[model samples]
Target: MHIVAVGLNYRKAPVDIREKFTFSDESLPVALQQLKRTKSILECVILSTCNRTEIYAVVDQQQVCGHYIRSFLANWFQIEIGEFADYLTIYEDNEAIRHLFSVTAGLDSMVIGETQILGQVRNAFLLAQKHNATGTLFNMLFKQAITMAKKAHSETSIGENPVSVSYAAVELGKKIYGNFKNKNVMIIGAGKMSELTLKHLHANGVGKIVVANRTLQKAKELAGQFAGTFCSMGQLEEMLVEQDIDIVISSTGADGYVLTLEQMEPVMKKRKSKPLFMIDIAVPRDLDPRLMDMPNVYLYDIDDLEGIVESNLEQRKREAMKVDKLIEHELEMFHQWYRLLGVGPVIGALQEKANRIHQETMSNMLQKLPDLTEREIKVIRKLSKSMLTQMLHDPIMRIKELSAGRRGVEELDLIRELFALEDMLKEQARLPKDFLLESKPSESDDDRISPVNPVLA
Candidate 1:
């Protein structure tokens, strides 16, 4: 058996092409059923997110399975094969395993080191499991991937800092005050930037948001979204003093300063030295730069937030190296387990072949020794079984050890040829009963394990 991953991701496909292949939550089960119904695909999982849509499957033939998967995708999504074929990527075996590990570790995310992809990966596996689309191989692989992802997050600082400007502002707020649950937030504008910043703050449990804008209607509209209070820009000072707002996010479209040093110095004094955090996301700067020098007041402008974001991104990149090494370690461990799977069918076939020969010889001996007692016959049978096991022990152990390395399939084939167990091995090598019925590859196709390359036209 071989593992294969065929799909297009953010790196290879544009949003339009990626969206075309994306599977909806309601359609995922049906899609999985359709893929597994194909002759080549044995087991499968579909991972669809805003950035990528991937299909990971265990297949009987890697060489032709890519064609089968591509055909399935084109037919299912009702797209022309020529239209999106160039965007597809195919990975088999080790490459497939590494791709999955990287995805679960968040290394494949649009934003590196983001933790959301880890949960997304887990959800995809669970969805596949729910539909009975996965078996022993995928079950173990996905579980190990998730465990490795958790280890990456806990052991390294990949998800420690924020890499986006909006999130950086929130991170800065977190540094000043550990939690936002009790703090009041004051927004100086009702633009998209302010709304986005407010959204992050709200997510972090900020309380009692006050929206102040030149247009009272827009302020009220934005404030209504968060169930917070609204006010006109004229009452900004009163709201600053009376509302006890701890964080001020200003993004007004005014050339002049909205909150000058002269205006905030008195408000700072009235608040009895309470610490204030301000984020100014305006081009000309809404909050006066001089306000940063004021006692108990911390201010960050657009450039400042961008600097923090850049620095955090660098830190995440550094942490990603640690995650990469962790993935390599986990991949080796998973490969060891996967290699052992090949040994089982081969060993089973060998045992079956030997038992047949032993039974044939014993039947002929029993005919010759008709006077032998039934108890003596039983003793002879037990001795024959014990000798067979002892004789095969060393060879079986060597086959298992060799199977864990690169020449596993070659060695197994040699063993089958040597024991004249070709037919027996073929029966044992058939896809498991639980798997969907599929056409087996011909003898000539057995050695054709190479994957189809994406048409980069």
Candidate 2:
């Protein structure tokens, strides 16, 4: 199988395009079923989120699969190939496998250690599994990928940091205040990050939420979703003073700081020095960085939250080395399985050899012993079949174990060379019932990272 991952992500596509590809919970099933209808695709899974829209497929002919899938995306999003290709990225074979592993491990996520993507991956795989759109290759690949992601989280300190700049701000709040269950949150700015962080704060159990944007209508629209208060920038300071916000997450698109230390200094004095967690995720930084040094004022600029994001990213990178080793081990195991995938052909040749010999012997004996009773002939046939099974049992068992991946591919390859399987197939005219039992066993695109590429059909 030629495993391929083709899609666009937050890194490659803007929010509008990304949102265009986002799979709503209501529509994933239909899209997944549609993906399977394309030719060359033996199995498929679609993972769509706000940040990415990726398809994982096992195909017979890669060029065919790639074309159909790309065209499908163009049609679905109503964009030309040239127009859309600018935002798309593709990975074939082992690069595809590595990408899947990295994604599940949180290395490729927008948030380095956020636990959400893992759930999304699981949900996508499960959706495919439900439709029987997944085969052995994908089932094994996805299952193992999930396990590796968990290992990355459990075995490292990568999950110790925030995943997004907005989330980093919330994390800074949690670090200082422990829980957000009873705290009020006023999400400043109407940008998408601000919207997403507002959702995160709600999900994290913030008691009350307030949306304050430059446009009161946008704020009102967003406030409707979270059931929060809405206000305009004209009323910014007044709203800030009136609401008693415990946390401020700002992503306002402004040329300069929206909240200065002088403005906030009096606000703090008006209220009795209540600790405030102010996170400015705006590019120009909505809050003054100098305000961080003030008492009862915990302010973080975009650079500071992003600094945490970078350090956390480095930590995730360090932890990913361990996941890499795990994938390495699994890759070796898969190679062995691939070698063993040839077991069906081996056993077929062997069984045919035995049966042919048995048939010839019986034919000649039956002509010679014309007076032989029917019972006697039947007994001879039964005896010959018993001998065949007993003679082949041990070797067949060993070859099968090798095929099932218990034996390494190199060792299995040695067995194939020893048995001269290519020559055997040429010599044998007919194969038995078990000839292709596993039907393309080593057909996994996710092979080990090695000096050699998988011997593709």
Candidate 3:
């Protein structure tokens, strides 16, 4: 069996390209089912988010599964392969495991150390489990990754700082007001960025929120999330002046300033020189820079927040080093489990082969000594079985140890060849209905051995 991951992420694909491949919640189940239906794919999971769309699968080694995965994506999304293939990245086996671990740990995020991605990863895994898209390997792998992520967060400072721009904006707010509970906030737009900033503010217990946007419905929808008021863009100036808003967060798409000094001066004066903290996260500069010159007014732009984000990221990077060590340790544990899985059929085959030889030899000896009593025959059979077990114990232990090492798979292959256990192992797949009750292999069964079972050669 081979583990593979095929996807395009924020690092390799632009937003336009990434958006093209995004799988909505409604579409995810369909996509997962379709992917798993492919001939090479045995087990599958799909993780789709704003920044990436990744597919993880356990597949047959007889064919190049990566090619089939890419083709599946193209056909499912109705896009030409050449359109986004250049941006896709493929990781096989250990690399795929590492990629998933890094992603779950938030090391692969655009904002390093952000906690949201961990939740997103968990949700993706749960969705896959709910749809039955993930089988034994993914079930174990994803659970391990989540456990490691939890440990990383609890044992390290990786998720302790604010690394996102929205978070940095909140940090700035906290610095000025010392607390958000008493500060009234006015959001100048209802876009995703505004919603994110508002989420941070609400988490900090900010006072009443007022959302103003070009579309009153969008403003109301966003405001409803925080139990805040909503108003049209035309009412922004009036609301700002009348409500005595203390913090103004603007993230509008307007080409010009959304809040100019000319518009905010009177609002500031109406409050009798009360402090006003403004953050302009918009690209075209939502607030006039001249607003900074006004008394009791502090205005910061996107560039100002970037400096804090950079500093926070530097701290996160230091914490990430500790996370990397944790991941390394966890990876080895998973590899051990994986190797044990690979050696299971080998161990079963070896024991079966030994038991068969013991039974045959005992039968032949008994036939030549028909005068032996039933009790004596039973004694001989027991002694011979015990001796055979003792004889095979050391070699079995050695093979298990070797299988859990670097060249484990190679060692298992050698064991299968030396013991001539390949056919015996293959026969296991075709056992009769009462095979579990039967003492020996059946000759009539024709089922092929699972490719994942290493002893099948």
By lDDT, the best candidate is 3
Predicted structure 3, TM vs. truth:
0.73
Q: Please list the C-alpha lDDT of all candidates, in the order they appear.
A: 0.81, 0.74, 0.82
Ranking by lDDT: 3, 1, 2
Candidate 1 similarity to native, TM-score: 0.64
Deviation in Å, model 1, residue 139 alpha carbon: 1.8
TM-score winner between 1 and 3, please give it: 3
Off by over 4 Å in 1: 164-199, 202-308, 427-457
Off by over 4 Å in 3: 168-196, 202-208, 211-227, 230-308, 431-457
State the lDDT of candidate 2 residue by residue for 1-457, as single tens digits. 6899999986777654554565666777888888898788889999976567899999999777778889878877677888778888898977888888888877777667666688879989999999988987889889988887887778777677557656777777777678898898888887777877887787788888888887889999998888899998767667667888888888775656677877877788866788888876654446777888889887765444434456567877776677678767766655555554565556666665555666778789989999999899888777776776677677677666656654454555676577666566666436554554644645221121111112321
On TM-score, the candidate that comes out on top is 3
Tens-digit lDDT track of model 1 for 1-457? 8999889986788654665676767888899888889987788999886567899999998789988998999899899999998999989999999999999988877556777678788999998898889999999999999999999989999988755445767777887789998899998989776787788888899988999999999999999999999999889888988999999988776657899999988898999998888987664567888998999999887555534556668888899999999999999888777767667767767766767667777789889999999899878877876777677777777778787777767877787788787798677668586442465655423222222111110
Better of 1 and 2 by lDDT: 1
What's the TM-score of every candidate structure? 0.64, 0.62, 0.73
Q: Per the 3 Å backbone cut-off, how many clashing residue pairs does candidate 1 have? A: 0
